[model samples]
Target: MTSISILKKWNPRPTSLSQMNALLLRIPVSSPSMSPRRYSTRDRELQSAKLEIENAPIIRNNPGLSASVFRNLSKFIRSYDLMDHMLKVYIYKEGEKPVFHQPLMRGIYASEGWFMKLVEGNRKFVVRDPKKAHLFYLPFDSHMLRLTLSGQNVKNGKKVLEKYLKSYVGLIARKYSFWNRTEGADHFLVACHDWVWFSCINLILMS
Candidate 1:
């Protein structure tokens, strides 16, 4: 199957609108044909994590998890534990501030700002080397994007936002191989703007 098809099959659908703010795509890792020395460290680590999650034993009567909250409490707990211990993300250092690396901490969308701040400042999950990252982060703030670009008096603000995001994705794809690897199946962005979903629909449909 094509990479995008694989991604569509594995990517989880958000259960509610709240979950849509942070859409995390799943990366499919096929068994490597190359020798251990030739294989990339990121791929090896991701494959290891996948295997562990798949093989995790199902637990019953978990007090911390409610059946109403989780579809599969056992798998959810296992995944969370694995993510805590092994997940490494690399944030791209492209684009300017206020719209790119900067966060807006005083608005309804402030949660997105806080998330970006915490993740970027985090030392444990944030890695300097992209080769060691299991996932790639595009650290643009949706609130900032709307604030900065909406003032331009563009005829269609939504299209402008979409174009800007598409341009950013294109920029990253040309400069790095990660997006090209699985057609951005492992990349994620957190946005809280109301129009973000519509604006980034094209990017979301990429894989």
Candidate 2:
């Protein structure tokens, strides 16, 4: 081939080893063929935000402020940016709707349901891939569980919910290594029912 033709076809390599190293660092984590070991840029930003929060002093507290409220506010301020930019929730896709994927958006339990839908709909924070998630949200609706138990003994209803949760957790543990790895430290659920909260005790202990 002519030199001009060769030049047109030729691909330039990194000028130096250092340049190559820098280029490699910028590679995206979503590359299908390669699993990157380093933290993503988003994760790095979150780490820096966390450090800033941890070191920040308690600023401008009112005399009426309760210690608990103050502590909560402090934490919120510190982590708000991190949560907005880096938080990723992975909602499991195993279960059927109205119990798993579907949540009631009206009535007393609406908050729980609305929150789930809101988070799931927010592309900024919702990541379908479990590998990319910061938290695993168990999308089971407590209100639906209660509804499922209508006309049954209240105690039996609790047992039914507990049983379902146990099986659900078992499925997750068997299907993925995430639950087993942290003993469920990274798993969480949102529910407004007292009974539902009580039913989760065993599930939490397994973590």
Candidate 3:
């Protein structure tokens, strides 16, 4: 057979990721790398944005890739700055992409959407209708005193649990007439710390 015919007969598409990588390596193709000088400073900042997602435990726990979470993580990583991060996240619909952001940090933070949505929902439950009941946000010192004066040990005790507990106890409440494990006790258990901090714990713990 002619050389042209031979080339056509032997040509094959790489069938696996490893094979694809080997094929690309054989070619003179250049991909963006960790070269400090290759990309501009702004490009590096954009790349750093992915760190948030990579660091998130939810993303790390995904047995497989979660596309939606990855996309959102990419968006946050590409944010121009922390302020930009806040604005783009809080001001815009998460489903939309910002081309202005790119070269996201890396990896997938698999768990943010589920957690954040629950947080927002809990907040809404507190303020679904402001006109119906006056919302009072009391500081911790005042809250403690209010609890003390009212003779409620919700804040001080470890087990009596007049207050929310570390475990699912808060959600499971030892005395609920409608208590059922299926009633979203899991979510409460997972997000209890977040709820405390949001209310007025006044401290943030990484663990």
Count of residue pairs whose backbone atoms collide, per candidate:
0, 1, 4
| Overall lDDT per candidate, in order of appearance | 0.76, 0.70, 0.31
Q: Order of all candidates by TM-score, from best down to worst? A: 1, 2, 3
Query: lDDT tens digits, residues 131-205, model 2?
Result: 888778888888886676555665455556667778888888899877765567567889877655445665555
Which of the predicted structures, 1 or 2, would earn the higher lDDT when compared with the native? 1
lDDT of 1 by residue, 184-207 (tens): 767889986646765575655462
Model 2 clashing residue pairs (backbone): 183-207
lDDT of 3 by residue, 77-180 (tens): 43424424322111111111221111122224213334433434443333433122111111112222223334444444322222322232232234321112
Q: Which ten residues in a row have the lowest lDDT in candidate 2?
A: 29-38
Kindly report which residue stretches of model 1 are placed more than 4 angstroms away from their true locations once superposed. 1-39, 204-207
TM-score against truth, every candidate = 0.77, 0.67, 0.19
Question: What lDDT does candidate 2 reach at residue 201?
Answer: 60
RMSD of each: 8.2, 21.8, 24.8
lDDT of 1: 0.76
The total number of steric clashes, by the backbone 3 Å criterion, in model 1 comes to 0
Comparing candidate 1 with candidate 3, which one achieves the higher TM-score? 1
- Candidate 3 local accuracy as lDDT? 0.31
